[model samples]
Target: MPKTTAQLRQLWRAYECNEAEMAAIGFGPDRIRVARPAARAFTALAETMTRYRYFIRPADTDSYNCRTITGGTLKSLHAYGIALDVNWSTNPYVDHPGTRGPRFSPKPTQAERALDVKAGRADTDMTEAMIAEIESLCTATGLQLFKWGGHFGTLKDSMHFELDIGPDDLAGGLASR
Candidate 1:
């Protein structure tokens, strides 16, 4: 719902939740934190992943980092405790033909993908099936405001997910709950 980066940042500051406002979801070590407003959606996601036997390791799952984007000046949604990165070890972020150079091809060969993964340039575990399942789950869980970074045109951050709504909307939704 934020129209600009500044607006988004403002929203993040306004609605930024602490650890107590977060919910830990997933099984055993394969867990991640999400804002209370988004707990239900993420819980459902975790349950579905468990039901489908999706692979998500603790070291690869994280949330609520107070930092900017990897290489940009914009504040990350994780700084607001609303973004999550699942299985980042296997769902690496890749840059296409952009500022970071051409590391990702639209249709890459398995060998190329393997090399990319080894070189820390991309991931290999986020298969088409996984992507499809996650997208479908998000659509069905009333998490329409959550955006997947895999949809980025030039940058493929397949491990990332965040609620795209503004602070007021998020607060309102929480109030309704």
Candidate 2:
């Protein structure tokens, strides 16, 4: 069944997130309201999350305010209300210590996750199979997907997807009351 905004919000709450974060992910504060199609897509993603143990992570402060994209150099889909991070394990790409004590090689560090840009690692980390599942469910509900994990070569955030159009298009249809 197609998902409504209320359904999407409920799904997010199932993951133990608060309303504020949900609002950010839904782009509710932006000029554009979340479209029904996109809401359907988000609901599918939430259902998909059950498989991964309700595994969506909140955006870190940096990611929340992140302004750069494309290898840490350009603006990211997050800034556009088109993307989100799943499970923190994959997003930051932390480099921890090795078997050796302090003698280990330097862990991967970025100016501020700056490494996320140079390589498509961010989108790539999300895995195509997972993204496909979300896409499949979304498509079944007639929702178009815009996933960074699919189109980009970097990290793959299977949980992340949105409508290709902007908020302007969302005004009509289910959102226009």
Candidate 3:
């Protein structure tokens, strides 16, 4: 069935909505942005945060930036509001350190952060216990609602959660759960 205008309005409201409201409630960033579609997933993602305190800081959460990946041609999922990076300062994209010479994967800033993490400078890094809970929360939907970057073998983006499918797929998954 075709969606009603009211439904469209609600969906658009979700898409263009600002994230300040969530931050006000002590969840995410104050002014961060995400597509309405992604925001729906965010709602489900937040369900498992009750036990995990100190998980996110305003400075560490990033989303909905219109830019390319650190050093790649593909546009970042953030640009499409399909990605969110949390605790990025401590948990970085520490793919093969001192490797991939001359390859522009993460750019210089990330390279430096990766080096720092390898040197054990990441005091705020999320432990496996944290990710384990987060994993349960994100996967609760059963549609593979979110992907934890920490699971990335070489990249190790420990502070990130992102979605690949559309909102309906995520919604269906979340509903089933």
Candidate 4:
């Protein structure tokens, strides 16, 4: 439930979070920073992933980057510390056909994903069941739901997830979806 790029630009003049507004999730070297309002949700997600044995390597996970969306000028949710990427090596960002330059390729379809699994090109840990369970935890005391990037139609950033509520909605304890 992120806002449109125009809305985001208007809401956040610089699309940057102050250090005081950020918190760390996970442990030690694997920890990632995120907006304080979303720390609880991300913590719950990390715990859920651990419980489900969906191991994520630190090298492949990222959060809270101050950057624009890839291939676009708009600021990315990461700039707001509300987005995260997990196991990026196994679940890559892919453009849909005709959406990007010819150098980019279409995202894998269900059939292609299955083939990737068979060929050891992708990991099987990010199952629908795991996603469902994580999403279900959104209503827990201090947590909020996350929208999986896999659901994007034009481009597939399967490794990404972001708070499903906006900053204002989060402050108001409301969920957009």
Query: Highest TM-score: which candidate?
Result: 4
* Per-residue lDDT over 131-160 for candidate 3, one digit per residue giving the tens place of the 0 to 100 score: 566555433355455667666554666667
Would you list the rank order by TM-score, best first? 4, 1, 3, 2
Clashing residue pairs, backbone N/CA/C < 3 A, model 4: none
Q: Higher-TM-score candidate among 3 and 4? A: 4
Lowest summed-lDDT stretch of 10 residues in model 1? 99-108
TM-score on alpha carbons, each prediction = 0.67, 0.42, 0.62, 0.72
Better of 2 and 3 by lDDT: 3
- Clashes (candidate 3): 2
Judged by whole-model lDDT over C-alpha atoms, candidate 4 comes out at 0.66
Residue pairs in clash, model 3:
14-36, 15-36
lDDT tens digits by residue: candidate 2, 1-177: 334333333433322222233332332112222322345444445556556433343443122223455456644444433345544344433333332111111224322223443343342233334455655542333444444333323333333444444343333432210
Error of 4 at 93 (Å): 0.8
Model 4: runs farther than 4 Å from truth?
1-17, 27-29, 98-125, 140-144, 171-177
Segments in model 1 whose C-alpha atoms lie over 4 Å from true places:
1-10, 98-123, 138-145, 166-177
lDDT of 4 at 18: 58
Give the per-residue lDDT of model 4 (tens digit) for 67-160. Answer: 8888888678788787899878667776666452112112334445445744645433366666777776554234446777766767667789
For model 2, the stretches where C-alpha displacement exceeds 4 angstroms are 1-40, 51-54, 59-66, 70-74, 91-129, 139-143, 148-151, 154-162, 168-177
